[model samples]
Target chain A: MTIHQTPSRLVTIADVAREAGVGESTVSRVLRGQGSFSKRAGERVLEAADRLGYVPNRLAGSLAGNADSAGSQLVGVVIPSLTNIVFPDLLRGLTGALDGAGFQSVVGVSDYDPDREEALVAGLLSWRPAALVLTGLEHTELTVTRLRAAGIRIVEMIDTDGPGLDIAVGFSNRAVGHASARHLIGRGYRRIAYVGHDLGRDLRAAKRLAGFEAALAESGLALHARELVGDRSSAASGRAALEALMARVPDTDAVYFSNDDMALGGYFACLGRGWAVPERLALFGCHALDITEAMPQPLSTMRTPRLAIGRAAAEALSAGSPPGTIDLGFELSEGATA
Target chain B: MTIHQTPSRLVTIADVAREAGVGESTVSRVLRGQGSFSKRAGERVLEAADRLGYVPNRLAGSLAGNADSAGSQLVGVVIPSLTNIVFPDLLRGLTGALDGAGFQSVVGVSDYDPDREEALVAGLLSWRPAALVLTGLEHTELTVTRLRAAGIRIVEMIDTDGPGLDIAVGFSNRAVGHASARHLIGRGYRRIAYVGHDLGRDLRAAKRLAGFEAALAESGLALHARELVGDRSSAASGRAALEALMARVPDTDAVYFSNDDMALGGYFACLGRGWAVPERLALFGCHALDITEAMPQPLSTMRTPRLAIGRAAAEALSAGSPPGTIDLGFELSEGATA
Candidate 1:
């Protein structure tokens, strides 16, 4: 296909040097605008390069050890999913931080698949990024092997529960779940139910559920019922799942959702059924999204340091700090929902 | 800084060839897994390369005219913002399409700044991507010059109100606004106001507003009031903007928002104030988001072909189609809100 067609013979620095009647080093300095060179030589080189349609190959320059080149200004970021607002918030924080530091993020979405992540890792590594930032600590064996071999800084963001390959920046999902469960229990939500999306792909969500169940055991109370939607988390799926759960277990006192998207749906379901929140049913969620906060009765949820985690990850990479975990922690919002 | 430190003496293919006791061509074929080579020779090359920690330089391979290499499997995508779900939805569709074709998307967010977009275009182009996908048709002169000089396929997505650079895949924002205004007018609402975010940066929103105003002129009626939030569009901003607009002009019978995010915020504001929707103040928005639909009264808005635009953009690039526009038209969802 033409998509794979090699670009028509690109104009190189040598060609520019010849056309400008200058040395190759002069042409290089003029194009990079780095090392000092004669102004007249620079003008001629630029003119020649522009005339020949020469676009500098930063990839080759990076390989040639141009430390201050634009090639080294890129940070490869691999995230799980973009449909969820949490991931986008993470990206916003990251790009914001990176922008001020003159670093650009080249992002890849793996859709929560380890195989795809491995392939993406291999593909991004081929670009020779200055650093690589991954969503979670968990990765395939091959992905880890490639990263180790690549010899670049690796920052794992959004979860700090497990040991990281290089650097980890985030709060504990397990802790957020534990705190959320404790808050519900303290409010006398004994027959609480749980509604979530597929926990198989989302390990962080699975960890939160584990901690939630553990907290329930501590209170000698367990979920009265649970509904797991087979699809990705969304308001529509959350509404349907909550409906299915309430149909089977009508006495559920409270419902805990995987995240704000699902929780918003569950809240909508309750609103549609004329169920009084916190009296007929209490609904809670993770990630204190703005939309959730703007709800008529704000949702009771845990506010994970999403933006902070992203900023911290970029800062850690830029700072070249020692490899370790940086737990920014989370906060519990006691809204009117619970 | 150590961040730019050249990786310590990377092992080259020549080293692997010497260690594996094979020719350089044999080592290359083994590493690429293309062309013919003995199985034993392949195993030896792989073992030697792995032991020496050799990662193939696809960038060099690309320059060397390897058409089927991973270097050519990259498609650079530059979006405006990720905080808005619209951008992420576009990415979701793009990655989904690119993934099946064994291509990975390297994304850059411009934060709605033309200067940032120009820099991002230069940065991404340095990687020699097979195709470059941009958000809108508008670009700085330098950005246009670079794209023209790059000699690669360029796909401009999301708005088709003007001329495209190479390929355009989206619907007319002006048409969407005209239809939306007509819909509200047909519903017997005249005292309509508009609430939006910084239209200076979001040109598509500006086009919609222009079209909305044009349609109103045809009906010999203009906006009763308008609230333009100086910040980016969000649910919180939408809520505050609506509150401010309603306070300034209480007689406003209907309000149109930039998108569902802002409209959802206005919906919440109405709920908080106990304003009966469609009876006291009707609300309409764009991008019929799922959360908007789950509200007590589904939001009456236009459903722009967001995901389809992303898919079509990728398809156009992959199919190596000729330079033109592919307008995947939008839909008008007549939810109960308006």
Candidate 2:
């Protein structure tokens, strides 16, 4: 029953099995890393594959299209930024949980552009991933259409401003803003300003700003000065924005940053100026990063459940949980800065 | 046209065309996101796809068993860690260069395990990526065989310890270790201890440690004390390791960490103990991260060409550079630490 296949043709599982003198299912199990195969059988298949220079035709097997195409055990994760410690923390929890459960993560960074997110979606969807984890609920029309059309689980993470397409796992960015404003106002801070990157591009940051303004209006106070930088949110940007804002409004009492990255930079700026923290200038940030806690004074920021959300999302996806929202609320870390 | 098709069957490009009243070529162009298609035709295809719930099977068109697969213009990048700033910086440079060249990045984290790396490689390769970028040269036997057999371009990155599978783009880890040791020894420090994670797991770090020990042996001196921790490199680990090392051997004058993370933690420990840097004990690290420079006293470390290597690897892969080693050297920053 030996069938001689042309070497020029794309190598198939059967070709590998025939070359290795094994059954088709053995080759499939060994290559796909599924089912129980003897170590000897695995080694045989690998040796044959190496000798024959066989690269399995993954498309024809795993991606043949349908509900049962031997689909991948990969959860496609799309986030805004990799350098942002928040995203990495989230990924750590997710991958840790998923890997333990024999699942994997294929990650993509959207850079906070909804259009780019749409493109990333198209490419990720082409894989027909078991489930997809997106940064927020905001997505282009085509992105929504494609996900619904693809009929796979969708998990929107980090923000819960609106109804999700499928599953949602995060606190409202607006709520984080309101809580931050309340904390700042409760601390008797007036003439407050903001230091952040582009609010328009980062829709969640924009929503937070709206919530901050609303909370501030309740106290009959408004932002005195604000500095908007480019797309990237960095400590350098934070320092620069603080310098500019202070120059424009010397009487400014406190500044709420978009995140801890900027706040850490502002801390350095204060260090350079020899300003007494919370005395000359108080600072508050979001996403209490590990680096933030390691600072001389713990950063006055909200401790969002980044890692918890990731783990929960992975667990839910693994359990084949129905589409719904799971609100993992944020905690206020009223550190020395505030 | 509009011949009704059963949704049960996996939709193909041909099906999309007939449903949209367009040619198969037009549907191919639109769905593959290549070449050009008229706006009207693209809209018609999308509308028809949306109406018919067509999920284009990427495997068929993108993995047509040859070089002509309309496979996504994505480069699959596999790295060791996400929290490690070095990897992220490298990714930033790579994605920037690749993005400008009309390519996107699909990333996976290996957690510094070769076995996990093999699994990641399998999943990523399933996409038939345009190119593959991996962390180091020390892949498992099967991984090497698989890469050689896959026929796609391979770039072994970060460390050039040995020969690459296809292309190698990085500095020599041994060279870095030698350089670090030379710099420290040149400054007349003999009683140096090493604080690192599980060296048995992290081959690159082990190489660096070997180079360091060899240099020390050449100078007729051995390490005073070495404290090994769990299989994770972190500032906390560094702090704890330094504390343990100091408690074990109080006379140690300098410390060489596996990377900047351990060094930063040691720096924090020095800060907590009210020990002046470079006076009480000198510190040196590898991979001079951005935060290293922004420190009150800039860290004394080796500034590896992380970003440059990434950009070079991307440009080379994009330009189809022949399989060869591109040695992007490292720089030693003689700061207050050492």
Candidate 3:
């Protein structure tokens, strides 16, 4: 009676259960909207909770023994960049699927640092997330060790060049790179240059570079010159790299950028210099992002299934599907530029 | 001794404390990288933790009474869109400052729904975040009530059209609107139209509309036509909206879009139709996003200090500053378009 009458202290699950003539768990399940409950019991619990002005602290309830630990509803997503539209598009697909399934995405950005990624993964693991979604397969040894111990549903999104920790959902960058190189070379571009930002950090970009070079070697050619910038990918960086590359290798007939950002920059450089695209120098990139399509001359790039990858990852996690790789292939857009 | 020797079960703090010959609280602080302790004590704690292979679960330690509840190190940042580059830029600014400060931003997207925002706020609050960073001042009454009760540092970013519940960052949308209207008017554009997406949900856009209209009224000219979109703002939406509005009010001199996405769309529409920009239909927008500036004819828009707002808010939060407003103003970029 005294416990029920204590107005100074906030109402707890015990108080609601006692008032409703039910166990503590019945109140919790009904309040959390998790598990199953009888209609009359749920009604009683709600009515009692309402009468007591009980506001459930979901964090406390999450760790409580009665709550289903598997239904934590938190999926940790660690990506390379939030600034890039690619990651956000992936997030959109993730939220689109997960929102209805009663799940929320907790995001962390690594900014393309392996050590930082390791730190972020450890921090996310501490949250005891239901699952983990990370970018690429590359991780510190310590990170791999900890993740193995965590034993959560691990997913590596966006790139499938190498092996994933557990579940991998995305296309093969190597294939995309080979295709891009074949397309550009097949279109009669011999003297080609590669322009990219921080290839060392973006391992996927490095993999693409390898694939491009391998395909180029098969055609008895090599890059005229490669310009690398140690910065985040952006149009400005792309423009600067293109300008420097053109200055260094004046005879280059085409340029393949790591991604669309550098490609956009390269395009801007052409516009600035009044150079006829493809007529003077051809340009190509990866990732068919929106602005690339919106450009006056549509960017010749590969359309990767960013959103589909996110949705598949989430749906699989929700369904308690076994660990496997899902390879959603890419399509090359042979636009006006190339 | 047995507690320290158990390999099947995870090593607990008790085992570490016993091994280190220190209190559990001392061990927790050293492990969590929080609080202060003697150098000798820290060394002992680390050695014990290393020998025992103790990986502290942050979620458990967060609510554990021994840990500092205030230093959760998780700041909840709720924004409208990750699709739009604006939010990401804001996040970049925030994380830039907060990263070095040993804080991680736990993000949630409201998608411009007040009801959804209220729900998200409730969910974020359950985590008992160190701070709550929201998009706008406008929130559901219940949201405000709950925020008041949460007793955490509350920050409203992006818009300053109304009184904030607590700390307000970013520029005034109303002022930006008026300034934009005046700039166009000063450039001798009389017939103007507005293209926006979901004004009812995006209160800031609505406020801008009000300011734009008010400034127009002073010039004795009302908008030629207003096209409102119910969908998310995108380049395609902008292009479609411009086409519809142009077909409806073909003689309109200039179009004010909600943001750069719509403006970029309008610009693209002009490009696609081979219509001359500014001469045929002037395009103006808020937010001088990256791609906007990189366009062939740079977008005539205001450059809001998105990054600065984020940095200031984080800096203040780090410093434990009092509740107030930090108004980072905007700059108008008079590009070739308008």
Q: Which numbered prediction scores highest in TM-score against the true structure?
A: 1
The candidates score, on chain A by TM-score, as follows 0.88, 0.85, 0.91
In terms of lDDT, the poorest run of 10 residues in model 1 chain A is A1-10
- Which whole-number lDDT from 0 to 100 does residue B226 have in model 2? 91
lDDT of 1 at A124: 79
Q: What is the C-alpha RMSD of each candidate to the true structure, in Å?
A: 4.3, 5.2, 4.1
DockQ of 1: 0.44
Q: Count the backbone clashes (under 3 Å) in each candidate.
A: 0, 0, 0
Clashing pairs in 3: none
Better of 2 and 3 by TM-score: 3
* TM-scores, one per candidate: 0.91, 0.83, 0.90
Per-residue lDDT of model 1, residues A1-338, tens digit only:
12423345556789888999999999988877889998898899999988776777665666676433223566888999988899999988998898777676777888899998998898777766789999988999889877876778899999988999889999899998999999999999999999999999999999999899999999998878999999998998899999999999999999999989899999889888989998999999999998898888999999988999889988997888899999999998889999
lDDT at residue A215 of model 2 (Cα atoms): 93
C-alpha lDDT of residue B73 in model 2: 61
Q: Model 3 reaches what TM-score against the true structure? A: 0.90
Question: Top model by DockQ, which number?
Answer: 1
The C-alpha local distance difference test score for the whole of candidate 2 amounts to 0.81
Which DockQ values do the candidates obtain, in the order shown? Answer: 0.44, 0.29, 0.39
- Cα lDDT for residue B247, model 3? 86
Candidate 3: lDDT of A21? 99
- Give candidate 1 misplaced runs (Cα > 4 Å): A1-11, A15-22, A30-54, A66-73, B1-11, B30-54, B66-72
Task: Provide the clash count, candidate 3.
Answer: 0
